[model samples]
Each structure stands twice: as C-alpha cells, then as structure tokens.
Target: MRLRRHSLPEPRIQSKHTGMLQRFYNDVVLALGHGCGSSHLAGWRRCPPALTIICALTLGLSCKVHAQAAGNDADNANNTPAAPTCLPDGSGSLKARLSGAVQAELVWGNEGTECTGAVRPDGGIRVRFSHKDGVDGGRLVLLFGIAALREGQSAKALPVNVTVIREGLGEFYSTQGDNKCTLDEVRQEPLVGIPHRSRSYRIIARGFCTHPARAVRGNGVILLPRFDYVGRIDFDAEDKDETLEGGAMTAQGRMKQQ
Candidate 1:
C-alpha cells in the first residue's frame, strides 16, 4: 500500500459578510471605551457609553455565526435597547438578560458589601459588621463603598482610604460615596474639578456586637487603608512632633489593590 499526500482545506473567506463585519468591528471599539467607563466616554448626546459597548460586543460576536438568519436575529436583539430598570442606587447590582446591556458579575470576597452610608465633603461614611458579644469564634465581614462621579470624571482622580477617628469611632469616606452619586448628568450641570486638586477620603471598617448590643461592648475597629482607587498611597505621620501627634493623631497609609 502506498501513502498519498493530501492538501489541507483553505480557510473560508466570507465576502458578503465583509462590509457587515467591518461595521461590527467599529461598534466593538465604541463599546470598549464605554464599558470601562473611561473618562473619554463621557460626552453629550447618547446612552451610557458602557451600555453602548455591551451592545456592540454582543452583536459583533453574534455576527460570527455562519447562518445569515441566525446572525440577523442576534444583531437585532443587540440593537434593541431594553426598557430602563433602575436599582435602588446605581451600583453594579443591576442585571438585564438582553443580548446587549450593561451588567456585572461579582464573586465573593472580590465584591465586598456596599455600605449604605457615605462621607460628606466635610465628613465621611461609617460601616459596621455585626457580631455576637463574648463569642470567641466570629467571622469578619468586608464591605465596599464605591465612589460615584460624573459620566467621564468617574475614572479620573485616584481614590484614597483614610482613617479618621472621632472620640472613639472610626469613619470611612470615599471620593464618590454620597447622594452625589445618584445625581443625573443630563439634568445637573456640575463644575469640573481642577487637575491635581485631590480630596482625601476615609473609610471605617468596624466590628460591633449586634445581639443585645449595648454601651459599645465587644466593639473593635479594623482600619483597612486604601479601600479603592488606582494610584499611589502614602502612609506617614502627619507631624514630626512626638508630643501632639502620637498614636491618637498619627496617620498611616495602606495600599488597596485595584
């Protein structure tokens, strides 16, 4: 028996889909910038850039289908915008099953509890994890306080986590943690911040007793620095003087991974 040489089949090129595919690619590009909520995506005239990106990605991928009818169905679904459904707060908790829409998937420990309280321009937010009193074994809970910002401005300005103590309480504040988060850009004309003008925020993660809790018993404070944001953090003493700025007035910085 003799072995025969065989040529491999050439890759299929779909000429009819060329024009359609190019348009699809453009949509993907637009969606990428928006999905990440980059500063460049925020502009006048349009739906949220992030949402636009989701639609583009869905359509682009669906167009890969060899069957024209199937591809068209996918494309139509991507192009159709679902009715608006709002979350209590515009956190990443919103979910829509449409082919194209803004969405997020959170894994445990990765997505901490989003605290209900927030810090003011002059103040901050306090988060508490409840525990049973006198319990030798206890579980620690983690929470996240996301900062809200202008459509594009949200991506700018590094977020810093500072620990501010008042008498006996610790408070945490985020750059975008407040009612300011819910403000509508289309309805509200806001001031643009000057570059390099940064605000320091404080976030307090404290553990307290919930079972018959009274008189601040069995309470402890765990200060995790640099809760969120991507940038450099400085953990240093506010003052060199050993007299005034001891552990009480002393400040320290910790790095938070993005």
Candidate 2:
C-alpha cells in the first residue's frame, strides 16, 4: 500500500521585521533617486554622480534580496516541530511494574451511590494508573461503597470490560454507576492477570451516574487502580466527557503487565 504524504502549513513571517526591511528598501531607493536628480543639475559634463547613485542602488537591491532570504530561513526554522525523544531503558523515570496487585480507591467527586441510591456526604475521587509495559487487557472487580463499610465484609467484584485508548497516558474503562465509586476509588483497585507488554502505561478512572455495562461500549480501555499508584490519578469528568465523545488525545506514557 502506498502511504499518503500531507502538505505542511506555510511558515509565518515576522510582521515587524518584514515592515522594517520594506521601509529600509524604500528609503534606500528614494535616496538613490533623489541624489541622482541632484547630480544631473551640478553642471558636470558626464552624470558621474548619477552613475555612482546607480551603483549604490544596485548594492541596496542585493542587500534587500539577502535580507529576504535570511528572513525566510529564520521563518522556516521556527515553523518546524520538534522531534519526539526516545526513552531509555531502566531510566527510573517510571515505576510501572509491581510485584502483585495494585489497589484501586475513590479520591473525589462523590454525589451519591448507584446501588443504594444514598446521597454521598463527601465527593468521589478519581483514580490514575501508571505501569511498565502497555496494559493490554484486564478484568475489573467493582464493589459497592456501603458494602465495604460493613464489619468483616468486603465489596464484591463485579465483572467489567476494559479498553485502552492512549498507550501510556491512560486507558478508558467502564464500571457500574455508583456515587460511592469515585474516580479515586476506581484508581486504587487492583487489575489482575493482565498480560505483559513493553511500554509505560497510564490509567485514569472516572465514575459517572451511568451503569458500568453501558460505559464499556465502543472503543475504550479499562484497568483497576491501586492505592499506591492511585494518588497520581486526577479526577476530571470533563476529560471523560471528551473521551465519551470520541475526542483525540496524545499519550506521554505506556503500560503493560510485567
């Protein structure tokens, strides 16, 4: 298959510099013409002054051309985008690989609970996940918030579907709608049996008032977050809204199971 080539945008010229050069060129030409006219009335047999003016005019035109060329070069330099940098191995820049399961917890923006329909006094939290190796596929175990409040009882894990959009920056996943499950709660949970791949991965979670099954539709990535790595996750529903609308994004990290 043939790859298509796209045209780049034209470089912008600096208005101030362009105007200055234009004015300089006009002044030089006018000076040359004025001097030539004055020299013609000097009573000289030959118009020696006019000839000298001609030479000066020619030099000025050359200088203007040179200046334009230099300006174009500068414009082109400024317009070029910087190339992407390659990450080094074992750089300690990212600690994605963990020995076991990563915990997911709620951090902010909790209005209510989906299961019990109880009003949440405190808001929910957003969860974020970062890992070495790209997060390919994973299972999520969702539990109700009030259930965890009971003595000697843990929140039950509900089945969930996962999809990752951006590699390292984050993945999108769906969970059952509950006010207690804040973005931070989702980020602090563990993602079990995820296949390992090479790349840094970032996972962020947000809970909406919608059902988890409804959120998994279309193209989205999912993974549970643990308490340790969940602190880095940020909760902003506006971002989730964009993803829901199929917005474009660029990733600064990658994730996979170790």
Candidate 3:
C-alpha cells in the first residue's frame, strides 16, 4: 500500500509592526523551517510544538532586552549634574568705588555673583565676592581681625584690610604691612531661612580707606573711599591646621586675650 504525503500549512505572523526586532523574529521563524524550500512545511509539521515554544520565548526575551536598554538611557539622562547658579535669596550685595590709579565703580548683586565668608581660627573674618566674569571682571576680599564678633552687635573704627583684584590690573592691598582702612560700621545678625549645623551670621559692614591700597608689585594705588556689603560668616568653618592642641601657644594666647 502506497501512503500519500501531506504538508503542514505555513505559520502565520499576525502583527504588521516592521521594527528591527520584528524583522529579527521573522528571520528566526524562517530559520526554524517556516520557509526552507519545498520540504519546509514538512519539517514544521514534524516539530511544530517545539518551534512554537522557541518563537514565543525569543520574542519575550527581545522585548525585555529592548526595555532594559531604554531604561538605561533614561537613567543616564537623569544622572547628569546641574550647573551652578547664583544665590537664590536676595540677601547678597556689594558696592564700592575705586579711584586714583584704578578708577571704576563696582556693583554686585545676587544675580551672577557669589559671596562667601568664614571665621578664621584666630577669630578673624574673611569675606569674598566673586563675579561671573572672573577676576578680569571683579573680585573683592575683606579681612576683619576684630577678634570675636557677636551677633546683633555693632563695631566702629576697627582696623580692616581690603584687597581688590581685576583683569588688566594687578592685586592691590589696603596696606603693605598695616591695615590702612577702617571698618566704620559693622553689624552682625543671624541669617534667616537657612539651616546650618554651626553658628552662622550675616555680616553687614561699611568702611573707607584712610590710604589707598598699594599694588603688590607696581607703584599703583587704588583708593576706595567708600564701600559696603552684606555677607555671611560661619563660625565652625574648617581651619588650615585642624589638629591645633588646646595647650598650643597660639590657642593659649587667644584664650588669655579672651
């Protein structure tokens, strides 16, 4: 008795999506005997169950890999760092006029400007104002050696040193050896709306130079007749030598003065 040969019907893909993954799935199906010449249907008929299971698993794994790649791209975008900005609060400003060798009027506000202050280990204060344009634009530094300053307290006629630096000009100090400028009025108060572990205060000061700041390297002088600013100081700022012993001569001497 002669047996008649029968061929299985070709597998059907219903989805019309033409993505790379879809094409890859179609290739995988064809490689598994969907279309491998006249005997293709015969091979699929022999192992339809096994080939169907493999196609399902391959589609699932491809989808998972694509989803994982998309997730990684999103995470990389989120990890990018933000750019630095000026202080948001409207509490920082510096205004001053320079004359003599260097003549220019300087004004800095919270926009495109930054102010920082720290209390030195010797109980002095250092405040700096930097503009977005860098030193060429303008930079001012004030040093106060009035020992310990208390909140809500005001002082007058104290020795204060000033430094001015700008582009096209060299650094200028109030005096080569001694403070030639005076802090006519200075007041301190707690800064509001900011949380800090250590004591922080807003320092407001106005002053004038008794003698112009002489250039560090040249025979130029910058006379700042009047200047004022609003700055901040943190008492617990780190010092140069963090391990100064209590019995250290400098520490003891400061204690004795206190």
Candidate closest to the true structure, highest lDDT: 3
What is candidate 3's lDDT per residue for 97-196, written digit by digit as tens?
8787667677877665666666656556666665544436544443333443553467887777666555334343435323677878898777654445
If ranked by TM-score, best first, what sequence of candidates would result? 3, 2, 1
* Reference-based lDDT, each prediction: 0.28, 0.31, 0.60
* Root-mean-square deviation per candidate: 27.2, 18.0, 10.8
Sort the predicted structures by lDDT, highest score first: 3, 2, 1
Once superposed on the true structure, which residue ranges of model 3 sit more than 4 Å away at CA?
Answer: 1-88, 133-152, 167-172, 176-179, 192-198, 238-258
TM-score each candidate. Answer: 0.18, 0.30, 0.56
Query: Model 3, residue 26: what's the lDDT?
Result: 55
- In the predicted model 3, the residue pairs found to clash are 136-167
lDDT of 2 by residue, 13-64 (tens): 4676555555644565345544445334342324566567656866776688
- Which predicted model would earn the best TM-score? 3
Candidate 2 ranges beyond 4 A from true positions = 1-122, 128-164, 167-172, 175-258
